[model samples]
Target chain A: MIRFENAHIGYDHDLIEAIDFELPNSGIIGLFGKNGTGKSTLFKTIIGLQALRRGNIFIHHQNISEIPGKLLAKKVSYCPTQILSYGNLTVWDVVSNGRIPHLSWLGKLKTHDIELVENSLELMGISDIKQQLISECSDGQKQKAIIASALAQETSILLLDEPTAFLDYPSKQELLKQLSFISEAGKLIIVSSHDLDLFEELCDLKLLLSHHKIITSEDTDFNKYWDEFTTKGLAK
Target chain B: MTTGKLTYLLLGLLLLVLFILGIGLGSADIGFMEAIKSLFKSADSSPEAYIIQELRLPRSLVAILAGAGLAVSGLIMQTLFTNILAGPHILGVSSGASLFVALTILAGSTLGDMSLPFAAILGALTISSLILFASRMLSSGTILLIIGVMIASFCSACVSLLEYYADSSALRSFVIWTMGDFSAVGKTHLPTLAVFVMMSVAICFAFSKGLNALLMGESGAHALGFRVKSLRTWILFITAVLAGSITAYCGPIAFVGLAVPNLVRFIVKTANHQVMIPLVLLTGACFGLLCDIISRLPGDDRTLPVNVASALIGAPVVIIILLKYQKSIR
Candidate 1:
């Protein structure tokens, strides 16, 4: 379980303050917010890249801020919004890097590591494209490759920022389905994306950040606020 | 054989052939058999032996070491910055070394035979650490690259100013140093340059896996549990030691550091640093030996500077790589 207690997170100052929430331990949580409303900052804080200015983050009942970087990596896998700039890596090579935190300093891959990488590629249905360079992979294939890499990390919580960006409509739906499947397999998957209706259909819960407060699907007036948001967006 | 292994075997054979030619076919042509025989004889045993042991052997080793050092350094910088244009000199490490050496030459400071090398390492470390610190403040790689170029130019301006104030003989010596030479490396200094180059190469291999992880960019590598800052620092340090030592010993040999990696990558067709590390080193040594042979102007008393030979070869190779990979550059 990941818990944020009165967390105020941002680059220089608070974009969102006094955030208190406990993410569902084993399910897909879709995070939605308008542009510039601290979604990325919140993700960074949870990934342990940014510090919470005022409060504490607990992971499995332990304070996250005190966790060492390598140890933290074993618990959370993060995929950024942008395609990685490296062009030379093959899909298999990229997946292999997911084992970095678990390997010795020399990064020698053992039989177990190789098996895990193969398993991840198989799980994502990217086994056929394993030898393809990342530069050659289609948007959907690249998205799957990235997810496979995250899975290869074997983290309990996977954080993806805009995983469906640049993906086609059908590819977006397919990716969300895969994400939901993975979540059901017992990992906490938190994703932020602009595909709202699809995200809502697939995610087990929603963490809606607006007006400097986080409102979850469990809140009493959650549907009323969600309908108000839809009306506001449609009115705009 | 696998492409990587074949590349190594061919490069190794080429380096051996070039090494033999480098020693045998100088301005004064000695027979191949005589050169080989003299290499094993004591330096004082014969005039041929003296030439082989004292002059030809050391110069050949220097060429190989400098070439390998510069090429490997360039590869590391290119990988670290994730930019093809990045080279040992681009980060101002070489320029900083040049500035200090220029000052030492102008001031006529004699700290025995080791003054120039010591001073160059000091200057390179100083500038590289500054760049490392600036990298923390500047998040963009492009901006950091620009900053490095600006620093290099600033150092060049300082060198020019020093040149403007220097006397005739000092200016001449400084100009020759800038032109670069493998021939200046003597029997006494070869061991030190050899030690430095070999040590840097070892460190690079030790960091090879981390370097592969780094190709994914900083945030990506950090997420993989890499200490990006420390890895970058070590890379800069290794580059400084390699480039700084080579500059001190051979006077800023160019193009080899910037071009060899690209050439190797094109031929080998893989991004695995495990394969690249050895290939680049061997290819670099071959290139250096070839450049030295071209510069020697066989049987003539006069010879061209090895730096000129390298740029003559390296510039075109880089241009070709850029043309083929234009879309990848940005």
Candidate 2:
């Protein structure tokens, strides 16, 4: 379970405030907000990439700030929006990096780590292209590679910032199906995306960012709440 | 053997051949067999033995060390900044050493032979610390790179000002040093240079995992639970020590640091640091030996400057590789 208590998330100034909520251990939790609505900042705060200005975040009943980075990595994995394409890293290389926190100092992957990496590649359906350089991969393949990397972490909570951004319509549907499968396998995934229609069909719960606050709603009530929130111009 | 293993074997063999050639084909023109034989002979056995064992051996060893050190430094800087153009000198390390050497030479300091190397190390570390502080204040790698370039330009300006006012003899000595020579390092200074360079290389190898993680950029590495700030600190310190000590002993030999790693990457076609680190080290040693052999010119009594030979050899290889890998270089 992840819980935020009066959390203020932002750099310098709080882009979102009074963010008090508790999420269950497993399911797809859709985070909905327009641009500049603090969706990414909220994700950053939850991953401890950004500090919580005025409140506490509890992961599995333990305060998140108390966890060391390596330990936190085992609990929460994040896939950012922009992926780096400069290095000559192969798909295998990028995906295997997810095992770094668990690997020895030399970063020699043991049998178990290798299996996990392989499984992630298979799960993301990029196993055939494992030897292909990420720089040469298409945008959608790169997106899947990044997601597979996050999956290889085996973290309890996965935070994906626009995982479907570069994906095509069919790939997006396929990814949503994979996320559903991953959530059913007992991981809490909080994904922020602009594709509300698709997420509505997949997400078990919805959290809307409006008026510098996080308002939680059930999947059934998401459309009603979104309508009220949007009609009121609270997104402004 | 697989292609990767074959590449390693070929590189290792090449390095061995270069080492022997570096020791044999000097101004005295000793045969390869004689060079190998002299290694087992006493230092005072004969003029050939003495020259091979005492002078050329240390010179060649220094060449290997400087080459490997500077090349690895370049690799680290390139990976850290994610820029192919980034080299050890990009962070002002060489310029820092150069400025201090300029001060010591032009100021007419009557200090002993050890004073110049000491001054160079001091200047390099001073600049490295300033860079470390600037890295702390700034979060962006591009910004830090700009700051480093600015610092380097400032140091170069200072060196030019020093060169402008110095006497002719002092100016001449400093200019000759700037041209670079492997023979500048005597037998006595070999141990210090070896220790500093070897230790820094080992530390760099130990951080190979972090370096690989850094290929994803700072935020990605941090997300992987690597302490990006601490990693950056270690990288800076290592580069400073390697580049500093080499510049101190070798008078700022060029091209090896900037080109060798790129060549290795282009040939190997992978950014895996574990594979690249050792390859870069060996290739660099080979490059250094090759440059040293060329500089000596075997039969000619007059030696070409090591820097000139390195540039002459390195520039063409770099240009060709850059053209071939233009799409991937960015």
Candidate 3:
């Protein structure tokens, strides 16, 4: 379980303030917000890339700030919106990098680690492209590869920021389906995207960012909350 | 064997041949067999043995050290900044060394015979510390790169101004040093150069995993549980030590650092540092030996500068790589 207590997120002044929420251990929590709405900042804050301005976050009752970075990596994996294309790294090489936290000081991939990397590629249905260079992959393939890397981390919590930004319509739907399957396997996934209609179809819970606050809604009434959010001019 | 293993084997064999060749062919006319035989004989056994033991061996070893050191330094900088164009000299470490060397040469050297290398190292470390300080204040790698360029330009300008006032002999010697040569390191200084380069290379290998993680950029590496800030600092320090020491001994040997890593990446077709690091070391050693041999020009006593030979080879390779990847680069 993840819980936030009066968390203030941002640099300098708070972009989002007084964030208090509790999320179940397993579900797809769709984070919805317009551009520049602190979605990325919130994700960054949770992953410890950015500090909380005011309060605290707890993962499984352990304060996130107290969790060492290596330990936190085992608990939470993050996939950023844009992946810098390291020209010569193949899909397998990129995905295996997710196993860095679990490896020894030399970062050698043991047999088990290799198996996990293979499984991540298999899960994302990109096993065939494992040998292909990431720079040569299509947008959809690259997105899958990036997500597969996060999966290879084997974390309980995965956070994705604007994952569908560059993906085509069908690719986006496919990626959402993959996330849904991943969540079903007993992992908590918090994904941020502007695709509200897709979130309505797939997400188990919806969290909307409006007026520097997070408003939560159950799956059954997410459409109602989204409608209210959009119609009330709060999305702007 | 797999192609990767095959390529490694081939490169290793090539490096072996070049190592022996580097010892064999120089201003002296020792036959290849004689050179190989001299390797097992005592230094006092013969004139050829004495020459090889005293002069050729140290020179070739220095070449290997400088090549491997500079190449690995370039690789570290390239990965840290995530720019293909970055090299050992990118941070003005070489220029810093040059500035101090220039001062020592032009200012009528108060310090004795060891002054130039000492000054070079001091200058290089000073610039490295400045870059490290600036890195703390500025977050962007691109900005740091610009700062490095600015530092290099300032150092070069200082060097030029010093050149303007020096007497003809001092100016001529300074110009020759700028052209670079592998023969400057003798038996006495070989151990120091070897230790610095080997230590830096070992440290680099130890951080190969972190370097590979950095391929994802800083935030991505952080998410993977590596401390990006500390890693960057370590990389800078290693680059400084490697570049500083190599430039101190070899007088700013150019192009090998910038070209060899790119060539290895192009051949290996992978950015995994664990695989690339060793390959780069061997390729760089071969490249150094080849450049040294070319500079000597086997039949002729008049030797060309090592920098001219390296640039002649490296510039074309860099150009071809750029043209081949022009679309992506654009």
Candidate 4:
């Protein structure tokens, strides 16, 4: 379980709150927040890339800050908003790089490692284009390649920021379907996304970041609370 | 083999021919047939044999090492910055070394081989410290690059100042080194240069995964379990050594670093640093040797500096790379 306690994050002079949050035991959680709600910063903190002004982040009951680089990789994975710019790498190479945390500086993969990479490729449905250069891949395929790399990491939890931002309507829905399918296997999945219509159908939990309310069940009255919350904010 | 492997192999073979040409021909003009005979047995006793063994052979080896070192440095710079055009020169490490070298000469320090390389390395480390400081404190790669270039231009200005004040002898030596000449490398210096190149190349190759992780940018690499800060530190350290000594011995050779990694990526199409590292080494050696051949060809009474030759060649290749392959560099 990933847990955060009174995490106070600040950028330059401005401070985001000292808020506490925890991962639910199962399924997809939608981080529903407008731009500049500190969602991206929080993701960086959870991944142990950024230092916290207050509180601690615990992964699998162990503090994430204390883990080594390779070990951290074994436990957590993240997909950022910015696309990677590496020259001349094929789709196969990018996905296989997920195994780096498991390998040594001089490490090459064992057969099991190769199998896992193949599995990731197959799951992402990118096998036919595994040899295709990244420069040659389409937008959807490129998005899937990023997802495929996350899958190859085989972490218990996956964190993504705006995974569907550049994708088309069908691609967004397809990614939502994929995320839902992934979460069903008892993995903890969290994605910060903006597709409210797709989230309603596919998400198990909805978190309204700006308003500070979390809806933990599918049966939660999102419509009622959302209307009331927006009205209250306007009155202020 | 795939096209990538086949192209690298051909490049390797082409490098071998250039290597032979490097030993066979020079300003003295041994001529190919006689040079081969001299290799077998002092050329049936020619002054040519001593020149080849004592001068050209070591010089050629230095040329290879400098090329390979600069090439690998370019590879790491591109990976670290996540920009295709990024290289040691672009990032100002080379500039830092250039300034240090100019200062060393200006300070009345008549440097030996070891001291010259050592001073250059120290200078490069200083620049890396500045780049790292910006990368950590600012969280901006672009800012780091801009700062680096600013420092580099500052160094270039200093170099010009040094050029103006120096007497003819010092100025001549400085000018020759600046143009990246390998013809002056001595037999005694080859072993140390060789050891340095091999060890640094091994270290650079060892960081292949870290480099690949780096290409994905810092945050993504952090998630994949890489200590991104540490990895960047190591890569920068290795690049400094690879580039510094080459600059110390010869002068700052350009574009080979900027060109070789892109060239390898175009051929290999695998961003995995594992494959990219070895290919970069091979291709870098190939590039250096080829450039050396053009610089040292028989017609000129005084051989051209390798840098001048590489720039004439490298400028076109880089332009073509940018013009034709716009999407790949990204």
Candidate 5:
């Protein structure tokens, strides 16, 4: 489990504060917020990219701040929302990079590393397109490739920031379904999305970013936030 | 054969052929057999032997070193900026090196034979770090590119100021350097240039895996355990060393760094830096040797400047490759 204690997180100043929560080690977490809310910042803080303002974050009973980057990488994988154009990189090449921390300095992939890459590709159902350049992959396929790369890392905790932003409806559903399935494999998967319906239907837990605080609850309370989202939209 | 192996075989042959051509096809018109004999003989008193051993051999070595150095540096820059057009010269590194050379010339400061190159390296290092810090402040590649060009123009303006104050002799020397040549450094300097260039390439290969991870984007690389900021900084540092040393020796020879990696990428059709680095090195050396040979103009007593030859040769090849891979570039 990942536990946040009085977590105040942001880049410059605290965008959200008092984020006290314990995320179960194996479940699907839906992070939902308005455009300017601190969902991405929270994820960044947990993944050690952004500094926490005033708090302790513990991953698997070890303080996150004390863990080395490579060790931390082995435990948590982060997927950014924007996928930049990677010139000439095939799906296999991109996925293979996830084995970086696992490989030695020379980075000659071991047989097991290669097998993990293949397994991740198969898990993401992108084995057929493994040889295709990332630039040529469709938006949905590219998202899956990114997720496959994260999976290839074999981390226990996976954090994705707006993974479905540019994906179409079916693509979004497929990606979320994959995330839910991944959580079922005993990995903690946290995905930030605007898809309220999918979150209600697929996520085991939901964390709502509102008014500079994180409100956590089970999916039974998602309806409360849906009404809140629509009323806020109507008021605006 | 795979493209990689074929690229290796063809490049190796090209290097050999160009090495021979570089030695034999200069204005002296020595036979290939005579050049070979002269290369092995220590006491051949013939002017042909002297030229072959003293001038032509060092020039060939320097050409290969500078060419391969610039090409790999260009590859790293292209990867760092994620732009197909990025090169050693694009970020004003050459101009930065040139400005320092101008300062040393105009001031009449003497730092020994190695001082000028060291000064150039310092200049390149300073300017690269400035641009890197600017990258932290700005996110747009286009903005960073504009900043790099502006820095180049600024360095050129500084060079112009130094030129205005310089004596005619110093002015002439600076102008000659600007024109670019492979003949300036003699046998004395080749060992040092060879060592530095070799070390730079080694460092690049050591970081090739991390560099490959960088292609996935900075955050992605970071998540995969590569320190993106340090990686970028180290890349710039290595590029400065390679490019600065080349500029210090070869006077900022153009287009090899810009064009060679693009050409290699087109031929190989993969983004694996492990494969690309060695290929770029070999192809770059061959390309450089070829340019050096063409600059000699073989039969003509007067030869073209290497910069002009490189552009004349490299630019069109790059343009053709770009045209063919236009969609991929975007």
Candidate 6:
């Protein structure tokens, strides 16, 4: 199981702490907090993208930092918000890149690898746009293409940062439906977003960041959370 | 800019025609038949054959290689920095090579022909390190670009200072070197140059996937499980080797380093570096060869520098790009 024990992350002067947690085995774990509460920092930490300031994170009885970078990629695959700026790539090319972890430094693709990419495209309903460039797709199709990439990673856990930010009604619903299918395969999903209504609809458990630390939704001070969020325009 | 399959197919054909034309015309002007014969090492000993082997062939090859390398470097740099204007010459690296080269000539080092390219390579490495240092200190991409330009301006001032103090003969050498010449390339350096260019171009080809992973920006590549820093560093290294070495040997021929990739993008309408890069390579080679020919058209010692011709070709393209697809390309 993944565990964050007193882990903290800081950037030059700002610091965000992870008090403690034993991540649940298999369900969506929603992250919610005020703007400066370091919700994004915590998600980045779990993925090993941001360096920790103190304490350590462990995956399957081993410290994540100790694992080799390639091995670590295999263990924890992440799906951030759909990248807005990537140009020139098709849905297929972007999705197939998820196999980077399985490939050697030479990075050649085998037949099984092609099958995985195809399977993922079909699963995400992105097969219709498989040859279309990423920039050419609509919002929901882009997000599904992003999910196809994550599914291609074939990991036990998926970590997404604001999976539904800037999405419209039907687009957000389409993404939520995709996420539901994803979480059904005993896959553990962690999504951080301020789309409270949509987020609450999909996530099984919720996490909140406050007081420079992470805590469960049950332990969070709702009045204070909403006050900081409302005042800071974070929860809106 | 309309990239229907037909447009791309026509563009591909147009590029191929330009490449063959490039491989065909040169200083000694061999007939197509004799030139083709010379490639197989069985030409008859006419002046045509000697000219084909000694002058035209190597000159054409250098033009193609240098053009392709510079264009691909610009393409990769533009992608890596995510700035539309990030060309190979922007960071003062080319000027760096020109600087030490001017100094070497002023010193009358007698280091022979090879010393010039070597000195230029040294200058490129130094400037590249400076750019990397500036990047580390500066948070904003625009700031880093300006800082790099500031360094380039400083280097340019130094190049002018050397020109002012030098003897007439030395000054002429420095000026010719700066004008950039494919015709003057020594045969001895060609093999090493070819190998290095091919290897780095191959590296860029390999990184097409990684570069595409990067087209989404650094954070996006990270989420895709790439070591963004490692991949970016390698891209920089490859760009340097390709563009730096070409600038060192050929002087600062301009714009193919800046324009060809964008033209390829315009033609193909795909930013997939995999396809875009090879297109850049071919298109760059063809463009460079064409520019090299244009440099010779005035004749009678009125030959313009290749840089002047390229800037003519490039500036309009840049302006058009800015006016039209600037926002999306950026």
Q: Assess chain B of each prediction and give its TM-score.
A: 0.93, 0.89, 0.89, 0.90, 0.94, 0.87
lDDT of 1 by residue, A39-60 (tens): 8878777767677888998988
Q: Give residue B60's lDDT in candidate 1 (0 to 100).
A: 93
Q: Which residue pairs collide, candidate 6?
A: A88-B271
Report the error of model 2 at residue B82, Å.
0.9
Where is model 1 more than 4 Å wrong at Cα? A234-236, B110-112, B126-151
Over A1-236, each residue of candidate 3 has an lDDT whose tens digit, in order, gives: 89999999889998888988799999998898777779988888887888899999999999989999899889998898766655477888889999988989887889999999999999999999998877778877888888899999999999998788888998887888889899999999999987777787788888988678777884465567678778876552
**CA-only RMSD, every prediction:** 2.7, 2.9, 2.8, 3.4, 2.3, 3.8
> Residue B237 in model 2: shift from native, Å?
1.6
Best by TM-score: 5
Candidate 4, A103-141: lDDT as tens digits: 866858778888999988987789999988777887778
State TM-scores per candidate: 0.92, 0.92, 0.93, 0.90, 0.94, 0.87
- Once model 1 is optimally superposed onto the true structure by TM-score, how far is the C-alpha of residue A208 displaced, in angstroms? 1.1
lDDT of 1 by residue, B220-279 (tens): 677777678788988888888888889988987778887898888677555657777788
Tell me the tens digit of each residue's lDDT in model 6 across A111-228.
9988999999998877988888666777667777777887888888788877787678887787788787878888888888888878776778777777676657655575566456
| lDDT tens digits, residue span B1-330, model 4 | 487668777888877788788888777867877776666666336688887777777787888887888888888877777767778887788888977887787666654546777889888888867876765675455576678789889888989998899887787777777888776667777777787778999988887777877766678888887777777888888888888878887788888898888777667767777777778888888788877888876466777778878888789888977885677553
Worst 10 residues of 2 chain B by lDDT: B109-118
* Number of the candidate with higher lDDT, 4 or 6: 4
Model 4 clashing residue pairs (backbone): A69-B225, A73-B225, A89-B271, B38-B43
Judging by DockQ against the true structure, name the best candidate: 4
Per-residue lDDT tens digits for candidate 5, residues A1-236, read 89988989887888898878789989988888888788877877776778899989999999989988889999999888866655577888888888888888877888999999999999888999998877787877878888898999999999988888778888777777788788889999998988776676788887888778777774466567657865776312
